[model samples]
Target: MFRDEKGFRPTQQIFTEVPPKYDILNRILTLNLDEGWRRKASATILEENPSRVLDLCCGTADLTMHLARSAKQSAELYGLDFSHTMLARAKEKVALFGEDRVKLIQGDAGNMPFEDEFFDAVGISFGFRNLTFENPDARLHISEVFRVLKPGGRFVVLETSQPNNRLIRAGYHFYQKYITAPIGGLLSGNRPAYDYLAHSAINYYSIPEISEVLLEAGFSKVSGQPYLLGATAIVTAIK
Candidate 1:
């Protein structure tokens, strides 16, 4: 496992320990902007009209539910996460979106349990950063994403990115470091975990950097769309 400057590892324990308030905390931390990110990612995947889709690290199945409801293609959606508690919550909400169409699995991002070329499209929102922070080589997991994608499959990613505007970038860093981390620790009682995540966002790769990484992972035609003043980005690529 790779350790950041603070020696924090983005493991399942960090996530599972705060499952009960994870959704609400996310809403507060991002000022409800996280939903828009998921919406855009799901809309992009739905545009492909894929028959089968996987929501990698689909915490609480928010994106999975959105895809099932928005996709006119009647795509079969699957959500995978390493946290058992998170998956449990996802299972409880599966029926509202038609359980037959949406399935949830507890699994690793690096070693996904699905077969190669099994999905027509794969979408992961707000989860890729954790994998990148934890793994020594992010390609080990990105390669897994490539393996699961069918020929010409699309990969949709929504994660933190460096802000382009100097003023907005400074503000974003301030909020993540001083405000978001403390608030998350107060709410979830896991200061170190949230602190590491907050730091990760401020230090994560730029949109172009992530695009290049995907290209090196054997993806062709990579594109990144920035959102929320460049603080977040939606990256799309074809296998």
Candidate 2:
């Protein structure tokens, strides 16, 4: 089953409803640091000189475009997303970026269409948290990622993390609970959607736990590093 099947219909609704305001809300909600995070994530993937890359759950192709610009023009970049609304916007942005080599695929991340060992590198940003929400086993998506990556290929994840400092963690939680949701609602006109985003970000899995999941999925090596004082991170695992 697709990881999204485990997600309630509400999850799909939120994704669909938020697309028009997604980029703007994200910029305001993250204080524009999301762009920097994408750069950092794309840089990590590009370091491998991958010719074929997949940006799984690549909403609006934000990070995918970043990788496309940094990669060789001959490289092929594919972005997969479940939400049609989101993918539509991603297509517009990809074209605007002049990334003709990038292809957008609308499908489930848990059941990728690519062949075994098809991609040299794969990455996902904030979207990874959604996959974990109802996917307690994690194997569905994890195995899919492991299966599509070439042996020695890397899967890089950029997602939220628990802040290591108690005070900062408290502040972060406060912001999630009291600030982000309201601001998101104002921008997207979807209160529940924003509320879900807040809850997911604050309660998502830890960096160490994610590394273990990758290892269990058959990755050969795993490493993770926190950024922005542990509020976010880049975790990489090699297949």
Candidate 3:
């Protein structure tokens, strides 16, 4: 059964304070690579032209807007997040697309408000790590995604991953810890949030590791494509 209230209070607290500068900070932290990653993931998400799509944990609606822009005219897009502040920012951005086409909802990931097998495809960009890394209800969140997706639906994720190369992994961690954390914290005035983000990204699951997690969650098939020296990856899991 789903929890009555939102879980992950600490993560929620971090997010509550970052929405104002969240988008710009992300661009700065990722050197603008986050946009391209989302673009690629959005393209992959729409390849099947699913009639209904969801951008789960869709902070700031970056991926949601991408999906709306590329999806077929008849396709419906939904973005769900726990932060009202994040959803407010997302609402402003997605307004360019008609409201009827793209809907934004404030809600928890571990306990979403939707019928079973409701969506044809679900996508998360940079937010999956927030849901799963060190989260007590990680499996519940994944199960919620699985439950909401159609039998043959896809769960596409674009997120930070550990590099396979030992040297690159070390460098990546260094960049995340030293460069990303400081700069993002300084710019966003949320050092603790950035610190936590850097810590999580530095130690987040590798592509293979996360793929295994998806497989264990009952996905029939899982595949991944790494990018930028394997510092980030896009994983697609079929239900």
lDDT of 2 by residue, 1-239 (tens): 22223455345776775556678878888889999999999999989799999999998889988987899878899999988888888888889657477899999888999999999999998888778765554678888888999988999999998888899988998888789988887777766677777887778777897788777778867999998788889999988
lDDT of 2 at 205: 70
Q: 234, model 2: CA deviation in Å?
A: 0.6
Residue-wise C-alpha lDDT for candidate 1, range 1-239, written one tens digit per residue: 43435665734556786446888988999999888888889999878689999999888888887897787646778899988888888888878755686878888778999888999999999889987754585778899999999999999999999898899999999989999889988898777778778888988888999998898889999999999889999999999
Reference-based lDDT, residue 189, model 3: 72
Candidate 3 lDDT, tens digit per residue, 132-180?
8887889999999999999999999999999999999999999988998
TM-score (C-alpha) between model 2 and the true structure: 0.93
Better of 2 and 3 by TM-score: 3
Per TM-score, what order, best first?
3, 1, 2
Candidate 1 lands at a TM-score of: 0.93
Cα deviation at 49, candidate 3, in Å, is 0.6
CA lDDT of 86 in candidate 3? 83
Each model's Cα RMSD: 2.1, 2.9, 3.6
Best by lDDT: 3
Give all TM-scores, in the order shown. Answer: 0.93, 0.93, 0.94
TM-score of 3: 0.94
